[model samples]
Target: MAYYIGTNGLAAFSVINYLHAFMFLAFLGIGSTIQPMISYYYGARKPEMIKSTIRISELTVLSLGALFILIGFFGADFLVSIFGVASDTIADMAATGIHLFFLGYVFMGINFIYMTYYQSIGYIKPSVGITVFRGFILLILMLLILPYFFGINGIWLSLPVAESIVAVVLMVYARKGVMEQGTFERRF
Candidate 1:
């Protein structure tokens, strides 16, 4: 699509993707930190501890997500500039893509939190399902489908759409378990 859009689009995408890589790594770090802690608490049969851990992790992740949204929304030009994107066209594309793409961060952390939560609690299938949907299935579908309709803006919108959908599904699936007392057993 970028090739169709020309060199400026490709350059903008490259810069945005590079910055996205850093943001993704931070998301992974949050997941890594919570996974082990959740597993340990669950193993100890400490439901309250697990609840507390999740609360803290969710707060932290949401805060980070908010920060990311702010930066992506307001600091788009600065972010592009850091990569030395001097061309106005390229910079505008990068900044626009950044603004649109980072909307995913608002819900991205929820997907990560639940995916890691399910994995830590020994619910492998749901964990894997969430991971696959977020990382591949929904992403590929949106990447393929969205761009066909909206062109370049659709490409920018894909990740946010996929992430938001998965997050909603995960939340709905986990809702029953969340309200139940005792062990966080699998519902489906």
Candidate 2:
């Protein structure tokens, strides 16, 4: 008998959580590079610099998302052909999963801006809170919600949907801050 059947379910959850953490880390490098620059420009109150950075980051992330989406859509068949799965249904399902995962990247780009906005103001707690909530709580909520209705497909869609919600909230908070008429002095 396979030993996994005897282990506590927590082990499986731990493994899954570790995988998620690894994936999150994989994106951190790019985020790290862009985040500081966003903050620097924002702190300096250089509206033009801030605008330029946001525009460039958005375009770059959009292009990356588009490339991945294209691969998942058009190249899905070709890539799956290499695995020797020998089952058309399996290949199709895999391709569908890939497509579903990348569908939310566009919204994710917008979310990045909001999250970085807090960071730019030297207010890291809010940004950290959003990231943690998105990675952990939002995922848990999705696990609960996705299974009750659309099954795995719901889980696949959860990330993008949750991210979009977070983005909206962050934007609202940011807008309020601007409306409240507070000013930040340049650190330099």
Candidate 3:
């Protein structure tokens, strides 16, 4: 990616990758928390408990995501400087990347929860599909296609766009499933 996008792109990536370390770990923890609780509730045949757990988990994840976006948007330059990247070009590029890259956090938390939810409920395909599509196929396709069209900004935007697309699809289906209002249906 650095080779394709050049020094500035690499710098941008480096900054986000560093900051992403903690956030990613936290998100993983939050995401992983859903599975056992969900599975237990599902086994107990307690539909209401399942719905409540989903709501609470979604709220927690999305709130954390929003916090990450706020951090990225406000701390971009400071964050870049933390890496000792003094060049204005590199700093600006990294800041832009932070601003854009953080947007993925917005959708990612929800996606993570969905993945675990699907898995806990024995819906193996969607769970694995979510992981593969965002982390692999969609992301790789974006990495290849976006930079060609939107340049470095395209690279920064790829994860967010891919996450958003998957999130939208999952959310729509989820809305019609047990998580939404009305009686719980095994939709999707």
| Model 2 per-residue lDDT tens digits across residues 99-166 | 66556565565556556766776778777788787767886787678646765566556776676677
- In model 3, what is the error at residue 155, expressed in angstroms? 0.3
TM-score leaderboard ranking? 1, 3, 2
Q: Candidate 1 lDDT, tens digit per residue, 39-149?
A: 998888888877787778778878988999899989999999998877998999999999999988878888888888888888889889888898799999998999889
Which one is best on TM-score? 1
RMSD versus native structure for model 3: 1.9
Overlapping backbone residue pairs in candidate 1 total 0
List candidate 1 stretches off by more than 4 Å: none
Candidate-wise lDDT, in order: 0.84, 0.58, 0.84
Clash pairs (backbone) in predicted model 2:
none
lDDT of 3: 0.84
